[model samples]
Target: MTSLDDLPIRDDLRGLTPYGAPQLDVPVRLNVNENAYRVPEAVALDIVQQLARALPDANRYPDREFDALRAAFAGYLGHGLQSAQIWAGNGSNEVLQHVLQAFGGPGRSLLSFTPTYSMYPLLAQGVGMRWVPVPRADDFTLTPQAVREAIAEHDPDVVFLCSPNNPTGTAIDLETIEAAAEAARGIVLVDEAYAEFAHDRSRTALTLLERHPRLLVSRTMSKAFAFAGIRVGYLAADPAVIDALRLVRLPYHLSALTQAAAVAALRHSDAMLSRVDELRTQRDRIVDELTALGYRPYPSDANFVLVGGIDDPRATFEALLERGILVRDVGLPHTLRITAGTAAETTALLSAMAALRAE
Candidate 1:
């Protein structure tokens, strides 16, 4: 009966826990910021058909280069991108892991603003890279001047900017990204996993790529595409950067079925994404509803809202869980982050909130 303490694991990981969000089986699940809508019927049918076609080739290895998926991704991005400028993996987390593997190491460091995607530091630590998280403003906003100061002081090997960031749902403008890239002497990665839910599509950091070779923009099919189960995430960057990632990624990593399924979904992206507007409506409704309920809901460009007002967030989370509506208690004091689930789910959450307040 050997325990973990007896086995010789890496000292850094000896006491650490794995990354996870609660996967509860409640009637209303607004915890992980997953798109509530199922994949469009047409797209699902196409995926089934395409995977059926690719199933025979599963006996052989998938496209080691994933060339077709890259071409489709280029078309999807449509800012004069090519397959040479793209790289992908099971999810954006894996893509970022590649970045860290290629550039981050024991002596090097990764810099990002605080209260960001909690995974950033974990990714760095997994590879023995130092994670330096600077604090954001009280409103959860990053300023260009602050970015310059951090870069000037830390001189990290990589900088991460999570736009429409997780937990807080705060979005950083391109100016801040530009400043960070210009000030830093290393790669600047923008995590745009929630970009499609933004009110203004033009706010994306993709537009600045032509001038900033150091910039990398990561996106995923999980959110607006309603394809979280399929696990397709990609990055747009300089051809040299993509080439470097090729050195780190495992051979034929993406399965043939995943590639086929992603291609099918991308071909019907318009139909697949038709629910975004409705989700945005629901997200805003949550923001307004929380405000009216005397909670402080941060303005969100993403699908979830981070609201603060609970007398005890942990207790409120337990109360909501008992009511069959599960939301995220992100360790922020008096705050809980919730996905903008379907209308019925939203109603359940609001009803629970009102009931708890009255109590």
Candidate 2:
């Protein structure tokens, strides 16, 4: 009569708490950095129409290979089938887990920068791979020297670099990524979940796929394409790497609804880009306002801004929440990250902050 807890589990996950975004139902929700707008009515109708037409076969399993969706995704990215390697999963998170399964193991290591996406370390732990982090410079830039040193020292099997990094919103330069790719002995994974919001062009790690067979560029429809709920994320890498992921991935990992929704979303890409531009403008305005308030907002190339050295970020976060504004308190003691919402939501957030300051 052994209790469930009495059984031995993977030692690595013994004391781990699950990772999650904050759950609050505040008026101006901004905790998760979601695109602050909903899919346009036309796009929504298009998706509904597509799904309605395809529901007869919805009872059947999705295409195991996801060939059509993959081709659509590659076409959207302007990459051909051979040079256009892709793999789909429930989310980019799943794609990342597959990456760990394929490359990282008990003896291997996963490398990344500190105060970046929190998922990298968690994913490494989940896969029983050692997690190694190198602190970024105070400015949140990855110096080539630091990356070289880390690669030489830990020699990780998988490296996760989040551009326009989550929580920090600072993007790594192409030179830094190139140096890291050159230095790594194993796979270099560039997580570009927030790339669309950035002013800089997406560093084409895809171009480097052939030369650096170890490089993988992971992307998601969640952020820019407004498809978070649909959960369609894909990875682009060398054909060999893509094939490896396909082998390790669960069959029919993406649902028919997800595929249909994703394809529809891509069809409405221009409309989505217009929304992204609006959000970027709102983000810039928020940053300027924060800076004028005497708070140092980190230079952001993403949908959110990270403000540090505040008096009490948690208190500030709570205060904002009390005022019906939701922002993320990243547990950095005196740092808070705020996502840019629509123009109206952004105005409300700033007004709430100003009122709180007056108090």
- Mind giving the per-residue lDDT tens digits that candidate 2 earns over 43-88? 9999999898778898899888877788887887764544338788
The TM-score of candidate 2 is 0.95
Off by over 4 Å in 1: none
RMSD of each: 0.9, 1.9
- Residue-level lDDT tens digits of model 1 in 104-173: 9789999999899999999999888999989899999998999999999999999999999998989999
Residue pairs in collision within model 2 = none
The lDDT values for all models are 0.91, 0.84
TM-score of every candidate? 0.98, 0.95
True-structure Cα RMSD, model 2: 1.9
